[model samples]
Target: MTPLFIFLVLLTSQVLGGLNNGASSKNVGGRRQPTGGGGLDENIPVIEIRGEGAPMSSAQIRHLEEMDNGGPLDIKIEKTFVPAKCPQQAKRLDFVTFHYKVFTEDNKKVYQTYGTGPVTIQLGTGMIMPGLDKGLKGMCAEELRKVRVPYRMSRKSKSKVWKNIPNDENWLIFNIEMVEIKPYTPEIQFKFLDLNEDEQLTNKEVQDFQKKMKKEFGKTWKNEDIDNVTAAGYYIKYFDVNGDGIVTEVEWLKIMDRDEKLINDKKTKEKGRKRDPGIGWILDFDNDGIVSYKENDEAADRFDAGPTLLPMESKDEL
Candidate 1:
């Protein structure tokens, strides 16, 4: 072959070799692939359900397998369900004040993992975890439900106790029990049966009213009044509903009105007695006017004098 012709042939061979190498590299990088049956793109997830006689998608099969294996796969869960007997999806208030028991995919109780408290969020307000709010919105009184909520929607920042939750996508399972649904009443009306406080009462003034009610009137008072006043004082300091250092009697009364109803209601037993009082036991259930049974170790610790070993107290003394 001529020298020039040989050089041109070599150049053509090198160009074809380079092109073949580039195609092979693209295949190795997974940039190009053959797809059959209109399969979903690899980047997007596909869901399919299978039965004895039905069609199923790849994603659905994987979802079922993951669930069977206790949710081993990373998946987002979102669903909304109303109570079976929901009277009206819009006017669901009473059922909204339910106590929920959150659970995990492994069937572990979340309350045990995190210390216990009712996931109590007022229905309409944005106070609750979003998934919880959405789950409770349409529930009726005395309904039991299980709903799944994606971690993205859960109140992560609020739950300092759930310390080790993964920051990425997660799901929450809630087992909700609709215990009771009742009317919403204000605290002042329940307290004095009067909305108009003759004057703006201070914390001490509110306390004095209770003392007067007990002493002069010779009528017994529920210890909840004292606890409400104490809590309202703290709310005034922290929340400042009206931006006053002190919560006005009107403002305080309004809070009490909202909270007091909860205290008086029959369903209040769980929340009222279980609350941590910080000080000595402040609530006297059964209208007995004294701290008795239902008080736990945490409650007894409040009464020890001068840093005593709270656990050292005798059972009788406790």
Candidate 2:
């Protein structure tokens, strides 16, 4: 019980306490062990603990890389083939014809235009998905590309689907080959129609154009052929905004602009609606948007009544 004994005891107790503290602070698996109170060490960094599951697939890995690059949901373009000379690359509002095969993330083919005819659509128009519209902007004829469209940029939900094309909350892959590009403008169309170079389209010229189109299409015309030929047939009746018999360049351009605006306005108003009536709704003779049972019956009767050639004056009066 002397002073020397008490000092030795105190030193031994202090040494034991230091050893325990050192053991508690030892690193385990590169992370600092928790202190004695069972709380995480403030110096230890946070670690994400993922549960065991199937290993990440290649597609998932690529998606992660995309996210790291800050473009996970952005459209991805991989040029498979680039022609040495791209004289005419597609631009906004240009008429482009292309063949494409659409696939899901697992490479399951959803839709395609291979055996069938290539699709022709005006770029920057909402005729196709937004991702595709932007992806095809700079493509040249014969050029091939692989485009990855994230779900966010594509049509989602069944209501937004178009033409029964597969549209779900998943990434869509497209293998596209540009077939042709045609510069389209109202002036170009008008010039082509005014073959005599008089800058005015007469009824005979319009009829001739329609005949030429019928010959060119050659018995392959479907009900959905809404092209220049159809427009020409209706020009004298509907597009000649004035009572003039011939359509001048100014009149043609003005009417064309007005019609385009009307079509665009209709599309905007019916953006999310199912069943766009298109031009076929004219059969809804009662002026109602929907085709009623009575209207269908009348149409059937007209079909059964045989084709009768009504006088042009009578037709105009009707």
Candidate 3:
């Protein structure tokens, strides 16, 4: 071949090689390979390879296997009825008024809230079983459902066994009907107590609110004729930071924040304090800054009997 012809042949070969290289560079192991710069290509989608890093130790593998086998099972829900006009649904931390009947796997009734009344509980508050709490989510008013609660999701205590509920590993079945859903928060509760839309909570307003809640929840005060002034003063004393008879929204929020901080601090500072004292303080229904022996006893009884889903009660009764 002539020298010019040889040069043309070499140039053609180089051009073909460059095209092949470009095609190969476009893809690597099913992922789009970045080009030119040592930076990810924003236009190309990146693929993630799970378990592609360091090999897990034998102990780690065993622990993961154990978790897979022993972790809580998801609650099974079977909807019985769903209303057409479902404007609202129960969600986490929302107050749900529900009527429930708990039964064993064998269909033996364990507990129920039919004859007495529907009970209200704040979802995700540890007031009910994890299964029940999760099952109640997304429930619209007047909706009926059958929930199967696994044994792992039920309440367990080494020191106490709930009455009628078997301590042995057994699942529960709940037939539930959602009555109402109230969106709840500390601010909402404060607004509820304010009552007058005056941006402040008065002692009388507090008293009236408590009375209204008691009646609404179908609970009676132990002392029917309990002194209203004294009862109201107790809550005012705890919430009213400026020694004023009325509690402003800011003051109420501040007290709540302080209580939360105190609880968190105690939890971090003291490892031995297993139970949150904030809950205990809340049990001081009289708001006297001390949980009385009677209060403790009542709480213990409630625990043994299974909580009634009533979040709060006066020191007098629930």
lDDT of 3 by residue, 115-197 (tens): 87787766754455668879999999999999988766766432111344454445689899999999867776666556689
TM-score, every prediction: 0.32, 0.44, 0.44
lDDT of 1 by residue, 170-203 (tens): 5567776665554433332223322245544345
Ranking by lDDT: 3, 2, 1
For model 2, residues 1-318, the per-residue Cα lDDT tens digits are 111211111223343344356555645446564545335333433444444556666456657767787875778899999999988889876788999998898998888888877877656534577798789999999999999887767762232223445656367899999999998687866775676899987778866754543443221112333344443444454445455667677776665564455455542321221211222222333332344545444544443342232112221332
Clashing pairs in 2: none
lDDT of 3: 0.60
Q: Which stretches of candidate 1 lie over 4 Å from their true place?
A: 1-97, 105-109, 112-117, 158-169, 185-318
TM-score of 1: 0.32
Off by over 4 Å in 2: 1-72, 156-164, 187-241, 244-250, 254-318
